[model samples]
Target chain A: MKETLLPSSIKNKEKRSAVHAKLKQQKKVEKKRNQKVREAAEKKALELGEDPPPKKTPRTIENTRELDETVCKPDDEELFAGNDADEFSSILKQECIPKILITTSRFHSSRGPDFIEDLRSIIPNAHYYKRGTYDLKKIVEYAKKKDFTSVIVVHTNRREPDALLIIGIPNGPTAHFKLSKLVLRKDIKNHGNPTSHQPELVLNNFTTRLGHRVGRLIQSLFPQDPHFNGRRVVTFHNQRDFVFFRHHRYIFETKESKTPEGKDKKENKAARPGKVVARLQECGPRFTLKLTSLQNGTFDTQGGEYEWVHKPEMDTSRRRFFL
Target chain B: MPRTTTVESPGCPPLRALTFDSLGLVKVIEAHDGQDGGAVKMVERWGDPDSSKCVLAASILDRESDPLVSVARKCGSIEVISAINGDLRAQIPNHGDEDDAITGLHLFSKQQSESSSRACKLFTCTTKGHARMESIELGGTVAEFVRDPSPTVWDVCGSGNILCSKIDGNENYALFGGKGVEVNLWDLQKCVKIWTAKCPPKNTLGIFTPTWFTSATFLSKDDHRKFVAGTNSHQVRLYDISAQRRPVISVDFRETPIKAVCEDIDGNTIYIGNGSGDLASIDMRTGKLLGCFIGKCSGGIKSIARHPQLPVIASCGLDSYLRIWDIQSRQLLSAVFLKQHLTSVVFDSHFRKEVPVPEVTNTVEEAEVIETPAKRKKGFKDEHTSKKKKSKRSSKKRLSDDED
Candidate 1:
């Protein structure tokens, strides 16, 4: 202290000058530029009738002098790698068994003949028989004629977790569905060709979801009417939408280009399901399923694809022998 | 959630907190499909039972200790029924477990199966209406009870013998009622009797289309032998069952004429629920108004009964709500809205095991869930026609036996 740097301030100034002499003058010019920017911002705020001030930031202590990428890299990369591997496995191994359907009563409303049109509201792909029906039934006959293992009623119901049935087979994936509480009054008894074979699955969980659905359906018939309990379920949502009646199941591919041409000009239209949509799983309490080897696009209408089957007993996928 | 309701489990999700204006005593609830569907409302019929989820029309869910079994009132009469007919369920818990883990020890083992032929005889009443005093199995399959063609044989009342047929057990005693009063005793063998005193009436018959008396009971104190018919009107008549042709009490309700009456429990108490959801409890001794409960219901009040263990009065209405009221506290204990209409109410307190009976609120779901053990087909098989012949031999005998 006695030998005191002849005025520590003078000594510090000399040190700064020596360091500054080697550096370019741009550092000083940059500082002036930053000051100008700050002034301009403050001036703008004042003009706008606002208050502007420098913000205070809390200081944080730095623990380590340097980062070690090796410490965090391996586990994180492995986690990401694992995720990618799972996604690949799930996608490739995914397969689904046939679906189980629970058909409700088909009695038309007392309102009369026009009620058939109402049927379309509930049955997405209703097959009419004059031209469509006879053939459909014939197909069922063909299945039974071939002595297929069993028949299946394909439909939907509401039960959580399995909101949609047939999520997937032991390794296969199933179709997707969106379910509503409304009950549908559909008579599907005469649709399939006369087949004598019993169905692969008989769904008994019909009453719960069907009652809910029918309750909804009955309510729909008389919108303003109260339910059997004198209570009405009324909840509105922005995205609530009903399925578009798919009167024809033939528009396998061309349907994807439905949006206006310009909405997404760059969209790659090639990947659509045109008969092979990547469906999401939905309601599934009454679902029954079986494994078959038929590829996408064409499905057995009667749910009888005998040629494609898995014989767990034989531990093999054996093709059905057609006479 | 709307299947069956009790104190611990209220059937319906709470309605919108902003309650709406209700009409009369009954209020209706309606809901449409998602955002764009229709609605269905329950209608209340006065006097007759509401058959929605008609398990009991019998009685609404109560605070009784039993599980899945409800005791509903037929006017003042009590009868019991299981909430889930396990014989009708595929995954019946009481049907026992399917231990599929035999593993390496028993490699070729098959799932063992059992027949429910005997269990089918548990949950039904053989006789439907007035009956001639004949010995019959009381609570069993509905199929075993034969509907007697004789006019006075139960359910055939309108067809014939209301006097000789209406009685409990195969005893030679008969129970009848009067106008605004209670039940009377008559002898099945002797045809008529004399009673001691008269009690008050409680309900009307809606489905049977008769003056189905209410609050009628035979006290063990000597049976209807000690009690007499009550008449609240001038046109009313009374009979002394213990004696012959003696009138104990004659009463009337209207100046014109009151026909019959009945009592609930043992004539000590009686309950009467009206169309407007009004339930009145009366003290049988003096016919005094013990208490009255007023609540809004959408269906007609068909039947009502007191909780066997709780201070609740259960009522069934055409509105599909099996409602329980805390008569002492004058509060609504609970309401179970059914998807189906109710036609009758009987109370039975037999303990039913705990089981997840499927949805009663869903008409479809209920039917679907009960697909288990459904009736066998009456038709034939296409394959192995020879086997069909064998099946025919057995199945034909079954239909005639009517064991199903």
Candidate 2:
């Protein structure tokens, strides 16, 4: 006999309502921001003592695209290999993280989706730009508002990229990248200036293949078959949303957040303590293969792809080790 | 341990295509399917001693479940690729450790200079009329696309470089000769200017198309590159790669023109297929016909491939038969007939099963794609003008867009 886990429908509905309301509020904010821009232009004109030109009404077609696009909304926890749990919590309280964007070139002869399938293991809360169609301008817009921890770019071939990996968590505004560009090292305080304890990792001689020409005309072995396509989807996928989450007993990393409107409040719930970076992108390269207990969840596109309130529980390191 | 072995099964799907590389069997590709250009399956058999044969993948879609017509294929040392993903992959039985799949199929393609950003890949051709190539460094995904605009761009050169042969599907040739007389030196991808030279002409007593017998190689002792172009002209022309120099030695043989020239017994002795279908042994250092063991055959000898480890020479000709001839004794050890009349032949070390060629029948879809007999008569008037348009290689615009 297998255990059948059922989610609380009331909680889900509440989360959905909050998200929808937030979206509407964001739209109103955008309209106000546009008026501010208009006012700012008029104030400058008044300072110069010159009459401003008449504002023209924008023309539009009825059948136009309807979607929000913003470039940098950082996710909840931005971890660039930082070990300080306290520092991350304090950063979250200040509320300033930027979303990450990872874009690469597409080859002339092939099409496939790989990185989108394997990202759950790395980042806790992340989503990809799956808008059915590809639009760079629109993608960039989403990246602006997306909360991201870090952006990692990789390539399968030499000249150009075969894929892109982006992880967007929340801890932004400023990161340890500005502190020292090091991994898991700290700063030493002294009477005057404090010397850093962890030196920045050796990053010299590191080359990234981002924007390069890729296709059969350039490569001697140009006539490549596609990586993945419709047939592949039919063979492998259980659903459009093949989302899985795993909790490893040995390693703990989680992002914590509170329910909005002051409901079901708990004392340390809002604090993202000991939580690892939540990633929006899944299906990527693996650094090391570790055993973990994974759980699967059903996610429908009926709601928006980004559900902020559906934030995962906080993750912490193991308290005790037997071996 | 018997590291390498070649089996001859008479009842196997009459071998359609065969290609051989240095390590032995490149690929024995088989194509089957009648509906929708006939579905295809490919299996990779290996000849390397340590590693076992590894199964590649299968890509086939048959509506009627019948075999297909003749399909061209390419084979190489590292990888094997074809225009149609057929059922030829079933022949390669799986074995060995995970990493020890098949040897890299495109091993022949070497980097000339770092000037270009992309890595140059090489492929091998089997006697089964199949061409195969494998990705070298950028290895994850490798697939070729057949453009409707540039339809007949399929072609393979002496260098294992796969390119478009006929621009608009005519006989736009870059390599042709009587027993491969003139070895055409072509920078096919760059200049596209074909440099032809008079080497050896096929002397198979005036029968069949002439094939080239040149195998371009490098001289390790001097770090120099050269080519040994064999001709049915009873001569072998050696060209130095440094200067695209003239022939170093045009070795004329005794009594027969060179039809087939291949490496034998450590690259010292060259196996020569003479004009009279005679197999001769010659010393590489001094081009001397040491022995003319086998006297004659019914068909003109066109192709010859040496065994990877054994002193064996596999030969084929217009007779539609492949014979594995021994160098020591002029005896026919094993022989097999091909499914169709072959254009060329090579022994692939990766050949596993002699899969039976399934019977191919016309499908309703193929009938619809092609014009009916009554309409085909009227089509000629319009076809004459269309033929000229179809023949031009530079015309890449789709017919739909070009109608404007």
For all candidates in order, the CA lDDT equals 0.30, 0.33
Local distance difference test, candidate 1:
0.30
Residue B334, model 1, lDDT: 51
Per-residue lDDT over B55-92 for candidate 1, one digit per residue giving the tens place of the 0 to 100 score: 22122222121112222222222222223231211111
Model 2's chain B yields a TM-score of: 0.41
Model 2: per-residue Cα lDDT at residue B337: 41
Predict model 2's lDDT versus the native.
Answer: 0.33
lDDT of 1 at B298: 30
DockQ per candidate: 0.01, 0.00
Model 1 lDDT, residue B96, Cα: 14
